[model samples]
Target: AAALISGHEDAYDGFICDEQSVPAAPGEFGVALDASLAVWQQKGYRGIWLKMPAAKAHVIGHAVDRGFEFHHAEKEYVMLTRWLPSSENKLPPNASHQVGMGAFVMNERREVLVVQERSGPLRGQGVWKMPTGLVQQGEDISEAAEREVLEETGIRARFDAVLAMRQAHGFAFGKSDMFFVVALKMEAGPQARELCMQEDELVGVRWMGLEEYLAVPFTAARPLFQKIHAAILAYVNGTY
Candidate 1:
């Protein structure tokens, strides 16, 4: 009974092969699996996942011959899966991972904080954006936001809320980066007029009103710029 496999209604789509049901002997294991798959087909289950422990690695060859393919692996186990006859599965391509954090900060005057890079990808392009940087290992995202803002603008600020999250693959060197934008309220640490840009990275740092921020040709075209705009409105309305 596919319906009885789990309480959830979608159980008919797949079944999980139990580790306990794996026979120690190679011959018996194959025999048992052939019969199990036949029954699954008649019961309308579309696929089955087999989880094998590191200790039972010898069974990998037999599992592969029976149509199972590698799905994912962990430190202690490898998971193999197969689709039943007449079923099709669409799997995504493998990808790389990277993550970054940004800060959308505004002072009491409603002017947004922005930075111009001195080096790296957009050097000397005259494009202004919120202070953003890659998240460091063992650093919390919120902490990364605060650190990036102060490091670039020399203006201390406290994180208020997550304004938005945007991501894309193949951003650079065939890697994917997830960028999170956080809203922040300016604190009384550094004055904008005395801005201190980070050496070798930032060339300019200052505050600008929404109209001026969007007026920057490069800044207005960014997808996240619109999200920051809406967030600023919500923040000013006391509803963010």
Candidate 2:
């Protein structure tokens, strides 16, 4: 028997087949795979997703031969999906799946915190972006956002909410990068006291008015800056 999962907010409604769920029998895999797809289709699900441990290549190969397409992968598993009769069958925007976090912090004066990297491709290019970094292994996304802000700008902040998220393939050295821009409230009192730059890594750290930040000319990050500016506007207008 195959395990069918549904009613989950983050996952698509689908069925999963694997060693644990379906015991390995000589020709049982093919029979189970077809039966699961048939049941899901009969139940009116638009798509079916299959996830298997990377070690189960044979099982995954069978599903792939039956039209399951690659979706994404993780350290221990690979995800594959097949669209049902009424499904659109669109692939995810980025399959490489590198996750990153960014901090959009605003002070009480409505000024946005910005940073300039000391080194890397954009160093000294006059393009200022939010405090951002790739999330470390096993790290919480929210914690990663807060940590990145403190590391680059030396300004501690509290995560307010996730304002926006986007994915781009071949970003930052040709790797797929999924970026999350989170809203952070600058901590008050002693915590918010100074503009300390990570000297070795950042060229500058300062707070600028949202409008001023938006109006500044950007080199390669113009699109991203515009998106962040839009997110700020949305927050102010209570749309986000």
Best by lDDT: 1
When summed lDDT is taken over every stretch of 10 residues in candidate 1, the lowest stretch is: 1-10
Q: Which lDDT tens digits does candidate 1 get at residues 1-240?
A: 211112111445777876766665677767777777777778777667777888878877898998998887778988887877664574333336678987888777778888988888899788788788998768888888888887777778787888778788887767798888788777764473356789768888888896787667775676667676677678667888
Measured by TM-score, the strongest candidate is 2
Residue pairs clashing in model 1 are none
Worst 10 residues of 2 by lDDT: 3-12
TM-score of each: 0.56, 0.57
lDDT of 2 at 175: 79
lDDT at residue 152 of model 1 (Cα atoms)? 78
TM-score of 1: 0.56
Each prediction's RMSD to truth: 7.7, 7.5
For residues 128-169, write the lDDT of model 2, one tens digit per residue: 777888888788888998888887777888888888888889
For residue 165, give model 2's deviation from the true position in Å: 1.1
